[model samples]
Target chain A: MTATSPTARTGQVASAQPSARPGKRGDRTGAASRAPWLLLAPFLALFILTFVLPIFVAVGSSFTKVTRSGLFGEAGVKSEFAGFSNYAQALADGSFVASIGRMLLFGVVQVPVMIVLCTVLALMLESASAKWPGFFRAAYFLPYGVPGVIATILWSFLYVPGLSPLFDVAALVGLTPDFLGANTVLWSIANIVTWSYTGYNMLIIVAQLKAIPGELYEAAKVDGASTWRVALSIQLPLIRPALVLTTVFSIIGTLQLFAEAQVLKTVAPTIDSQYTPNLSAYTTAFAYNDYNVAAAQAVLIAVAAFVLSFAFLKFTNRKSS
Target chain B: MTATVTPTSTSASPARTSAAGTRRSGSKGRPSTIIVTAVLVVVALYFLIPVYWVVVAATKSTEDLFSTNGFWFAPTVALWDNLAQVLSYDNGIFIRWFLNSVLYAGIGALLATYFAAAGGYALAKYEFRGRNLVFGTILGGVLVPGTATALPLFLLFSQLGLANTYWSVLLPSLVSPFGLFLCRIYSQATVDTSLIEAARLDGAGELRIFHTIGLRVLTPALVTVFLFQLVGIWNNYFLPLVMLSDSGLYPITLGLNNWLSQVDRLPEFYELTTGGVLLSIIPLSIAMVVLQRFWRGGLTEGSVK
Candidate 1:
C-alpha cells in the first residue's frame, strides 16, 4: 500500500461545517452499535470476494502448473505446483520483457507531459482573464466521455491515408505522415491518449486551484506580484498534492494499456499479441491457454504498477514534507 | 468567430477567449492575448475534429464511407438510414448492447453508490473496534489495478460456472474502492456528528437515522461517487471482454471492438461500426455535461484536503 493512498492523504482541512465530536465519543447505544457492522457487511463482503480473494487466488495459482492430456488443453487437465518457473518463463520471453520496458518509457514521457499540460491549462483557464472557462473546460473534457475503443476507431480514420481531411491538408504542404507505420504507431496511440486525458487531468488540477483561498490571490496582488510571478511562487507549490495524485493515477493507467493496442492490432502491423504486459497476460491466458503462466504475468503487471506508483508517492511526499 | 471587437469591457464572448489574455487589466489586444486565443482555439479544434468526423461518417452509406472525405458530409445524408441499419443489424444487437451498457452502468453504479455511502458513513460516524482495520484493508484495494483482478476473477468465475454470464461482470462492477475512499473522505468532512446525535435523540432507529440524516447530509458526496462509478462501469472494457463470450451480454465497448475487428472482411460493418460508436457516446456526453459539478466537487474533496 502507498504511504498516503489518496484517501488518507487528506485528513485535516478547514471543514465548512462545524462538528462537536473531536475525540471518539463513548456511545454504546443498543441498535446504533450494531448498525455500523450491518451497514458495512454487504460492501465488505463483496469487496473481499471480488478484490481481495482474486489477488490471493492469482498469486496462489501463479505458483502452480497445469498439465493437459489433449491438444489445445481441450481435455482433462490437472494443475500442480509450478514453483518459480512461470516467473522465470515470463521474464525470459523477450516480448513480455520488452512490453514492460515499453510501458516504462511510455509512462516516463507521457505522465510528465500530461501533468504539465493539465496544470498549465488549469492555471490559464482558472485565471481571472480567461473567457468562457466553463465552455472550454467542457470542450476539452468532451473526449474523456468517448470510450477508448471509440476514440481509437475515430482516430484511425484520421490516420488512414485516404480517409482523413487531415491527411489531405498535410499533403498540400508536402508532408505525408504515416501514422500507422511501425515506428510512428506507438506515438500515434500516445496522441490519442493525450487528447482524451489532458482535459480530465486538467479538471482535477482546476478543482485544486479552485480550493485555494481567494485571500491568497488578493494578498499576492496587494504585493504587486505579476501574474507569472504569482503562478510560480504560490500556485505551483500549493497544487503539488493534485500533481502527485494525478501522477500516480497516470502511472497506473499507462501500465494497464491494452484496449487501444488490442483494437489497433489488425490495422497496425507493429502491434502484436504481446504488445503490452496486460495484453501479454491476456493472450497467454485466453489464446495460449496457460492460466498459470498468465497469472504470473498478471501478478508482475500489478507489482510493476505498485512499485512505480509507490516510488512516485514516496518521492513527492518527501519533497512536500 | 468575429474579428471585430471594440473592447468596451461589457460584452464577453468566446472570441475574447484566449490562453492568457487579461480582460481583467483592460489589456484586450496584447500580443500575449492573441497568442493565448490562437493557441487555445487550435487546441479546441484538435479535440473537436475527430468528434465532428464521427458525426459526418455516421451519415454516410457504406459505399460513401469509402468514397467521400472522412471529415465532410456526403451528398446525401443517410443518417436515418444508418441509424436504422445499426439498430436493426444482426437482429438489433446494437440495441441490446446499448441496453446492456445502461443496465450495467445504471444498476451497478447505484448499488456501488449505496454501498459506499452506507459503509463510509459507518466508518465516519461509528467508533467500532475494527474500524481502522476494515477501513485500511479497503484502502489497499485501491492500489490493485482492475486488469489484475479481472484475470483471476474470470478464472474463479469459470470454476464456479459463472463465466460468460452477466453476474461475472456485474458482480465485479459493483465494487469500487476509489468510490468508497471518496465517500469516507466526503462523509468525514461533511457529515457533522451533532446532527446524527440529535436524530438519534429524536427516537429514530439506527437505520432510519442513516436513511434520513446520514444519507441526506451525504447526498452530494453520494452523487459524486455515483457519477464516477457510473462512468467507470460504462467505460469498462476488459471485464466484459474477459467475462462474457455471449454477444447478447456484450456492452458497447466490447461490441464496438468486436465490430472493428471484423470490418476488413465484411466491409458493410463500417457504417454499422461508425454509427454504433456515434450512438454509444450520445448518452455519456449528456451525462458529463449534467453531472459536471458533482465530479468537480468529488475531485476537490479528495485531492485538496
Candidate 2:
C-alpha cells in the first residue's frame, strides 16, 4: 500500500518526461498541476465548513437578541440589536465571578505544584547515576495515557467515602478526612489534575533534558560543584522553553477543569452547579436554556483566558528577556 | 532524594587501592538498590491501585464488594456473572453506550487527525498569501479553551439544523487547533525542505509529494497526533453532553455520567458502571502500549527543536 502509491506516480511522471518541447507542454503541465488542487479539495472544504464558518457565525450571533411584542408575544419573535446587554448580564452574575475566582485559585495552586513535581521527576530521570530510569519514566507516564474522563472516574471511585480503599485505610487509621467535602473539594480536584498531568509535563521536560547536549552535564561533572548545583545552574536555565510550554498548557487545562468536577459532583453533592468557570457556562447554556446568556459567558471566559495567558506570557517573556 | 547523589569522580579513580577501598562501599549498593526499587514499586502501585480496585469491584456483587477484602482476593468468582448482568442491564443499553463512545472517539479522532495533519503540513511547507495571518489565527485558536468554544459552537450547530446528530459531535472534534499547531511544528522539524524541492524538480505533483514523502517522514508526528486526538475525543464529555440529546449518541464518559446520576436509585448500576469504566479503558491502554514508542520520539523531538 505504501510503496505502490508513490512509486507508480513517480514512474508515470518519469516516463512522460520527453513528451513535448513547446509552449503546449507548459499549457499541458499547468492543466496537470490542477490535479493537486483536486486532491486538496476535500480537506479544504471540510476545514471551511467545520471550522472557519462556525467562528464567523458565532461572532455574528453574539451581538443579537430575541424579543417579542406584547399581546402577541408568542406570535412573532425577531432578532434585535442588543448591543452589550448579554455581556453585561453575564458579567453581573455572581456565579461567573466565583467560577473565575475558583479557576484562578486552581491555576495558582495547581500549576506551580505540577511544574515543580515535573521538574524534580525530570531531574531524577535524567541523573546519570539513576538506574532503570527508562522504566521509571514509562511508569510515571502511564497515567497520562488514560483518558482524562477515565482518570477522573477512577479517581472518583477512590475519593468516594466508603467505597474507596484509600478511605478504608483512612478509616483504619482513625483519621477519616472527607476528600470530597466543600472545604477540600477544590484541592481534591487539583490532586487528580496533578496526578494525570505531572508525568506528561515531566516527559516534556525530559525531552528538553535529552536535547541539552551531554557535554553540559559532562562539563558540570568536571566542576567541583555537586549534583544539585549543576542542576540549578545548567539544567534549569536550559529547559526554560519547555517549562514555559508546559506552564501555558497547564494554565489552559486548569481553566477547562470540567470533566473532573462534573464526575465528582455526581458522587460528591457538595460540588455546586457552577464549580468551575466552564461548568458555569455549561449550566447557563444547557440547564437554564439561556443561549444568549451562555454565549455571553463563553465570550467572557475566552476573553479572561486570553488576557490571563497573554499577560502571563508577556510578563514571563519580559522578566526572562 | 538528597542521599542518592554520589559523586562519580571518586568512583572513576583508577586503582587497586580504589578497588580495595570500594569493596566495602559496594556492599551498601544492595540495600540502596533495594530501597530505590521498593520506592519505584510503591509509586507504580499508587498509579495502578485504583484501576486494580475498580476491576475487582466490578467483578464482585454489591455484597462481596463491601463484605470481602478491599483488594482483589478470593470469594468473588462473579466476574463473568457481573459482566453478563452489566451487559444485559437496562435492556443492554450499556453496550449501546459503549458502541456510541467508540463511534464518537474512533471516527472523530481519525478525521480530526487527517485535517490537522493536512492543515499543519500546508502551514509548514507552503508559502501562500496570509500565511502568517493563518498561522497566527491558529496560534490564537490554540489558546482558546474548547469549553469556551462549546456554547458558541452549540448555538451555531443548532442554527444549522445539525444539532443532536453525529456531525454535531464529529465536526467540532475535527477542528483541533492544538493538534494543528503540534503538527505544524512537527512537520517543520521533520520534513526536509531540500527533499521537497528535489521531489518538485523531478516533476512530481505537490499532492503526490505530500502523500509519499511528506507523510512518510511525518509518520512519527502523525502517530502522536492520532494518539492525542484519540484520547481527547474519547475523554470528551462536555461536547457530547452539550451537543447530543439522544442517549444513543452518548460517549462512554457522558453515558457513565448519566448512569452515575442514576446509580443511587439502582445499585446494580454501580457494578455496570464500574464494568463499563473498565471496558472503556481497554482500548486506550492498548493504544498506549502500541504507541508508547511514538510518544517518546514525538515528544522528545518536538521539545528538542
Candidate 3:
C-alpha cells in the first residue's frame, strides 16, 4: 500500500510535465481527452438511472395525488397534480412528526454515548501498555460483520421475556426489567444499534489513532505526560475528523431506523407499524397503498437527513479548520 | 509542521523504540493496565454473548429451546437436526434464500466495484469539463440515505414492470455511492497517470490500459470496495422488502426475517431462525477474519483522504 504513494507522486509530476505543453499541438493529448468521458460513461449511466431518476420520480410523485374516477373504483385510479397536498398531509401527520422526534431524541442520546464508548475502546486498544489488542479488536468488531437484522434478532431473543437468558438472570436477582416493554423498547433498539455499530466506529477512530505518529507518544512520555494525559491531549484532538464522520453517520442512521423496529414490531406489542419514520413510510406505501403520502414522507425524511448531516459537516469543519 | 516533526522524531526514534518496548513489558503489573484490560474483556463478552447464545440455541430441540437454559447446550445435541430442518423447511426455501443472497451480493459487488473503479480512475487521471460537477453530484449521493430511495424506486420499478423481480433489487444494489467515492480516492492514490499515458503510447486502447494496468494497481482498493458492497447488499433488508414481494426471491436477510416473524405463531421456527442466522453469518465472519487488512486499509484510506 505504501509503495503506491511514491509512484502516485511521480505520476503526478510525469503527467504535469506533458500537460504543460500546448494541448492542441499534441496528438497523444487529443486522443486522451475523450478517454475520461468514455471511462465514466458506464458509471454515469447507472448513477443517473438508479440515483438521479429515482429522486426525480420521488419528487414528482410527492407532488401528485391518486383519485378514483369510476364507481367502486374499478375503472382505475388517475393521478392528478395535487400541488403540495401530499407534503401538507405528511407534515400534518401526528405519528410521523412523533416518529421523527423519537428518532431525534434517539440520536441526541445515543450518538454521544456510542462515540465516547468507541473513543475509549480505541484508546484502550491503541495504548502501548494494552495487551492482546488484536483479540479484543476482532471480538469487538465481530458484531459489525453480523448483519443488522441478525444482530437485532439475536438481541430480541435476549429482550423477549421467556426466551431471554438475561430475563432468567434478572429473575434470579428478582429484578426483571421489561426490555421489550413499550416504555423501554426504544432504548432496547438503541442498544441493538450501538452494539452493531460501536466497533465499526472504534475501528475508524483506531485507524485515525494509528496515523498519529509514534513520535507524539514518545514526546509526551519524555515530557512526563501519562497515558491518560496523552490520550486526552493528543489522541482525542487528532481524531476529530473520524469522530465527526461517525457522528454524522450515526445521525443519518438514527433517522433511517426501520429494520430493527420493523422486525421488533412483531415481538413487541408496543411497536406499531409506524413506529419509525422509515417504517411509517414503508407501511403507508405498501400496507395502505398510499404511494403519494409515502413518497412525501420519504422526501421529508431525506431532506431531514440531508440537513442534519450537512449541518454537522459544516459545524465540524468550521471548528476543525 | 509535519516536516519539522518527522526529522526530530526519527533521530530520537531508536532510543524511543527500546524505551517503548521496555515500558510495554514492564507495564503488566500496573493497576491501570489491568483495569483497562478487564474493561475490554467485559466489553468483548458483551459483544460475544449473542453469538454464543445463538450457537448454543441452534443445538437444542424445540422442547429444549424453551425448557433448557438459554446460554448453554441441552441434554441432546440437535444442531444437525436443526440445520437439516431449516434447509428442508418450506420446500428448501432457506437454501434458496442463501443462494439468492450470494447471487445478489456477489454479482452486485462485482459490477459495482468495476463501475466505481472505472469511474474513479477516470475522475482521478483525466481532466475534463464538468468533472467537479460530476464528482459533487456523487458526493451528494453519499448523503442520501438508501431507505429514502426504496419507496420511490419501488414506484418506478413497478411502473417499468420490474417490481417483484430480481432486477429491481440487483439494479439498485449496484449503485453504491460510497464505493464509488472510495474508488475515486483509492485510484488517485494508487493508479499512476504516467502509466496510463505510457500504455496509451504503446498503442493500447483506453479500455485496454484500464483493464491491464489500471485494474492491477487498483486491485486492493477494488477488493475493499467489493467487500464493503458485498456485506452491504448481503445485509440489506429494506430494499428487498420494498421491491420484491415474492418470497422466492428474498435474500437471506429478508428470508430469515420472514421466518423470525412467524416464530410466534409457528413456534417451531425458533431453531430455524437461529440456524439460518448462523448459516448466513458464517461466510461474512470468515471474510472479515481473512480480509482484515483490506477492511482496515480501506476505511483508513477513505477517512484520511
Candidate 4:
C-alpha cells in the first residue's frame, strides 16, 4: 500500500516512462512525496481536535475519582488520582453489569435475525425476474430513509394494541399480547431495529451480489446448476465480505441501541432506567452528573465493543487473507 | 473509466446463453413468476404500510384517527391543522428544531464529506509516510462505538466550555471515519492519476488540481459519503441528549422524544407525536426521491469496475 502511488500506477497504465526515468528520480522525489501530507493536514487536524484529543482526555479522566468532604465551610469538590477506582466501582455496580449483560443478550438475539432477513431479502430481490426490482429495492430501503426517532414513533403506534391495525388483526386471531409489556419489550425494540435496518443491510448485500461476475452464473448454468444452488454456492460466498461488514455494523448499532428503547419507555414504564449500557452511561453523565464514573463506564463499554469488533475482524481477515 | 470500454466479458457470455433460456423458461412457468411477483409486492406493501398509515393518520383529527379505518382512507382532514399546531406549539420550536436538523445534517454532512473526500483522495492517489498507520487509526475510530464517545466527548466539551451548544452536536457529526474509508475506496476506483499529473504538469497548483480535476472525479463518491453522513446526523439523538440542555436547540428527533415522554400523561401528545413523526419523515423521503438515482448509480459503481 505504501509503495504504490498514483504516479507509478499512471505510468504503468499509460506505458510511459517517468519524464526522467531512473537517473533523475531524485529531482521529483522530495517535493512529490510531500503533497499527500499537505493534503491530509486539515483532516488530521480535525481528527486530533475532535476525536483523538477527546479520547485521551477520557482515558485520563477515567483514572480519577471525585470526593467532597472538608473545607472552610465551603463546598469541597476534589479530584484524586485514584487508579482503577472508577473502573472498579463501575464494574461492581449492579446496574452497570446488568446493562452490559442485557445488551449482549439483545445483540445475540437481534443481529442474527437481522442478517438473515437482510440476506434473504437481498437474494429475493436479486433473483427476481420481475420488472420492478429497482422499485422494490427502493421500497425495501424506505425504512432506512426514515430517521430512527421517527421510525420508533411510527412503530409505537403500530405496537399500541388499540391503535395498530396489525395488532387488531392479531387480536382477531386470538393473540392479545401487549407490544410493550415487560415480557415483550425487548423483542419490540428488536422489531423496530430489524424494520429500520433490513433495507440498509440488504442494499449492502445486494450491491455485493451485483458485483459478482455474470460469467460465474452462466458457467454454473452450463454445469446444470439450479437457482438455489447458484445462490448458495457462488452468490453467498462472493457476498461474504459484505455480510461480514453488515454484521460488524449491526453489532455496533445493537450495542448502542438507544432511540427505540428510549421512546418505548414512554409506553412501557417497566423498562428500567438503565436497560442498556448506553442508556446507563447517559443517565450517569446527564442525570446523575457523575462524569468521572460515567467516563470509566464508557471506557469499559467501548473496550468491550472494540474487543468484539476486533475479534470479528481478525477472524474474518485471517480467513479471507 | 477505461474498464467500461474494455468489452464486458462477463455479461457477453451470460447474455448469449440466458437469452435462449429466458424464452423457454418464460413459457414453462409464467404463472409461478406472476405468483412470485405478487408475493414480492405483498412483502413490499407490508414494509410500506406503516408509512402510508402515518400519512393518512396525519391527515385525520384525533377523533377520526381512531374512528376511521386504520390502514387506509381517513374520515377527516387535519393535516394542516396538526401541522399548524405542531409548528405553533411551544412557540414554533418544532420549526427551530427542523432548522437545527438542517444545519446539523446539512452543514455537518457537507464538511464531513469534504474531509472524507480530501483525506480519501490523498490516501488513494498518493504514497506517503505512515499512510497505513494513519488509515489504521481512522479504521480504529470506526470500530469504537459512538455511545462510548458521547460521554467522553461531553467531558471534553465541558472542559472547553462548549457543552450544551450547537458545536457539540455539529463537531462530532463531522468526524465520519467510515465515510472517509468509503470515499478513499471510491476515489481509488474513479479517479485516473494521469489526468491529475497532466494538470499538475500544466502548472495547476495542488489545490487547484484538487478543486478542478480531483473534485470533479470524486463527485459520485462524495455524494455517497454525503448521503451517509446526512442520514447519520439526522438520526443522531444520543449526542444531543448528552450535549444539549435547552429545549430551544433541540432537533426534531430530540423534540419528538420530549413529546413521546409526555404522551403517557397526555394522550393528545400521541397524535402530535405521530404527526411529528409523519412530518419528520418528509425531508428524508424527499431526499431519497431526489437522490434515488444518484444513490443507486453510486452503489453499483464500485461493484462492476
Looking at model 3, the pairs that clash are none
Q: Distance from true position, residue B37, model 4, in Å?
A: 2.4
lDDT of 3 at B217: 87
Model 3 segments beyond 4 Å from truth?
A1-27, A71-76, B1-26
Q: Write the per-residue lDDT of candidate 4 for residues B74-117, one digit (tens) a residue.
A: 75677899888888888888889999999999999999989888
**Per-candidate DockQ vs. reference:** 0.41, 0.29, 0.36, 0.34
For B1-305, candidate 1 gives per-residue lDDT tens digits of: 11111221212333343233242455465655555556566667777778889899999998888787776788999999999999998899998999999999999999999998889888888987899999999987888899999999999899999999889989998888888888788778888889888877777778888888888888877888888888888888898999999999999999988988888899878888889989998888877877777789877776544
What would the per-residue lDDT of candidate 3 be over residues A168-270, giving only the tens digit for each residue?
Answer: 8778889868887878999999889988888889888988888887788778777866554666688889998889889988999999999999888888999
User: What local lDDT does model 3 show for residue B136?
Assistant: 98
Which lDDT value does model 1 have at A233? Answer: 84
TM-scores, all candidates, are 0.90, 0.86, 0.91, 0.89
What is the Cα-based lDDT of residue A248 in candidate 2? 85
Over B1-305, each residue of candidate 2 has an lDDT whose tens digit, in order, gives 11112212222222112221221123234433344345455555665676788878887887776666667654747778878877787788878887877787788788877777777887787755566876787677778777777767777788899899988988777767777777888888889999987987797877788889888887787777877887778777788888889987777778777777787897777777788787777777666656666876787776545
Give the per-residue lDDT digits (tens) of candidate 1, residues A18-72.
Answer: 3223222224244666899998988999998899989999999999988888886
- Under CAPRI classification, how is model 1 graded? acceptable
- Quote the B-chain TM-score, candidate 4: 0.87
**Pairs that clash in candidate 1:** B18-B37, B19-B36
lDDT of all predictions, in order shown? 0.82, 0.73, 0.83, 0.78
Q: lDDT score, residue B3, model 2?
A: 13
Candidate 1 ranges beyond 4 A from true positions: A1-30, A70-76, B1-31, B302-305
Q: Kindly list the per-residue Cα lDDT of model 4 for residues A211-237, writing each as its tens digit.
A: 788788778778877555676789888
Candidate 2 off by > 4 Å: A1-52, A69-73, B1-39, B72-74
